[model samples]
Target: MTDTRKSTQNAVGAPGRAADGLAARLVVERGAFRLDVTLTAAPGDVVALLGPNGAGKTTALRALAGLVPLAGGHLRLDGAELDRTPPESRPVGVVFQDYLLFPHLSALDNVAFGPRCHGASRAEARAQAAAWLERMGLAEHAAAKPRRLSGGQAQRVALARALATHPRLLLLDEPLAALDARTRLDVRAQLRRHLADFEAVAVLVTHDPLDAMVLADHLVVIEDGRVVQEGTPADIARHPRTDYIAHLVGLNLYRGQARGHAVQVDGGCVVTTTEDLTGPAFVAFAPGAVTLHRERPAGSSARNLWRCEVAGLQSHGDQIRADLTGELPLAADLTTVAAAELDLRPGATVWATVKAAQTHAYPA
Candidate 1:
């Protein structure tokens, strides 16, 4: 939490910044899926590639690590081009989602494998692995096999193994995805500290927003193999440009053209806001700002009201989220007690209203 979030302005250079980092334009082609992404990171920066499943997040990481061949584009690290380099030959290290520890090898040997492959002597590699294990707080589990170690312990060993080579680029694909929620929190904090201390470019791929926000200095959101948005966590969270991003940040978003206080959404209902906006604009509001009534309320001060039917309802923490469809389709958050009092259910008719002041309008 102490690490400052960096701006994602240029993927290549920044004013007064060092050049010893990663800069890559990756393009990969499969049967139908294509991933074309531009990525950059500073020496002490941690970048996170975040998106939904099958959104080319992992493909980007693979391209960076040389696991997947690039159809076109360049990859450079520390001012050296590495587009044609092999995975092992490149100064890159990878921690896969599954941990992928060697089943037959002990923890120490697993951590030492990379050093040994890089031409270090057996004794030297083991000694270096022991140091890494101790750093990861896993020295006691050095003799344990992959199956014998806990999930958290195995994850640390994998990280230690990847770092043993001291690569310039560190790539992690869902680093904490294999662990349970409780263990994930613990490991995530540890991983954040490790990544912060790493004096090289680190790129992590994850679909979890919390993980992306917590571990990285900048976030690159990809969808359908394209870079949809890139910025610091706060920037992206506050001003999401796409519906996917709006959903991720828990906002009801609509694109429209504004005239004075009225905005007519494309293919959706019109929204009225207190802010005076003109031309192309977007309207967004939190679910909690929406007020639902069983019957149309008379003399209500709210300017926007829609007659909708409950399409679906689900529990969200202590509140309930209602998906409504009609003049305006939106998700609204309601307290459990209020939901029960109204006997809210699918197909039920409800009048939803939002005060003009609650809706935020901004230029698209």
Candidate 2:
């Protein structure tokens, strides 16, 4: 309910702003794939659509950009209904997975294409294009063709072109995906800065948890073409609704019953919670929340503690991921230094505890 038009103009500033701006709620259908998503992105909000393959993530993005038809739902931007609007008619910019720059055109020319198509003179388009390239730190590459540019440079050129259009909404489909692992880290950092500077609503689709966690302020987790969960990165990381989401973020979640911020597990063990939900519910704790010990503490007042044996171990960052099998299976992450101190290894007996504050519960 803010003054969306004025907000759009101020957010994108001069370089990234089009005439007005965008908001979209699109429902699309095709063969066996159906996408029904509702999104309200502000001028500067970066909402990430995350899911596995075939989860209709790209389908929803396509619908919003007008590349795909809206079988249902309506898209609005700057107070205009765009569900039936042609892709070109909507004030939206899209950067595809691959930087689809024209091989024959110089970076500046490619960036100028949109302004030209919208009826700007060649000189005017080139003027605007030059400024955008300079803003992206690609001023030297303005005369370079697609093949002459590095992957990250090409990506910036593509982004410059997209923003040059002055779109109210920007859509990036796996923007950093084409880069290799090392390149990905570099580009991802650069992309984060670019996205932060973008004033309008920018939506990105990615299967990478790190990408979603790092780049997006809000995440919409899709599975089987439906939104299974939507929240901030911390919320999703701490309280995953489904096992798939849990595994993606490397957490463990269990559904059970809760009575006053406490949940009873299937094996008669009770776990404390941080939620107020009653009746059937879910209790989640992160792997880092579970501290492993070689022996149970004699005078510990911990609410939920278990003695288990390590079934597996894997390296996760600077820490060790210990997979334990006992009354109920659990995964715990501890520093490599801690593991070394405990002398923990596969088949080792360990004690795990869940601090009451760490256990989160909500209605299932």
Candidate 1 minimal-lDDT segment of 10 residues:
7-16
Residue 33 in model 1: lDDT: 96
lDDT against the true structure, per candidate, is: 0.88, 0.84
Q: Which stretches of candidate 1 lie over 4 Å from their true place?
A: 1-19
Give lDDT tens digits, candidate 1, residues 5-111. Answer: 23232211212234568889999999899999999877778899988889999889988888899999999999999988888799899999999999999999999
- What is the Cα-based TM-score of model 1? 0.92
The digit string of per-residue lDDT tens for model 2 on 1-364 reads 1232234343224653443345566788888777888887767778999988988899988888888898877888767888788898888899999989999999999999999998999999999899888888889989999999989999999998898877778999999888888988988888887777777778899989999999898899988878999999998887788988989888778878888877887677677866777788878788898988898877777777888898988999888999999866899999989999989888999999888887777777
What is the Cα-based lDDT of residue 13 in candidate 1? 24
Pairs in steric clash, model 2: 18-166
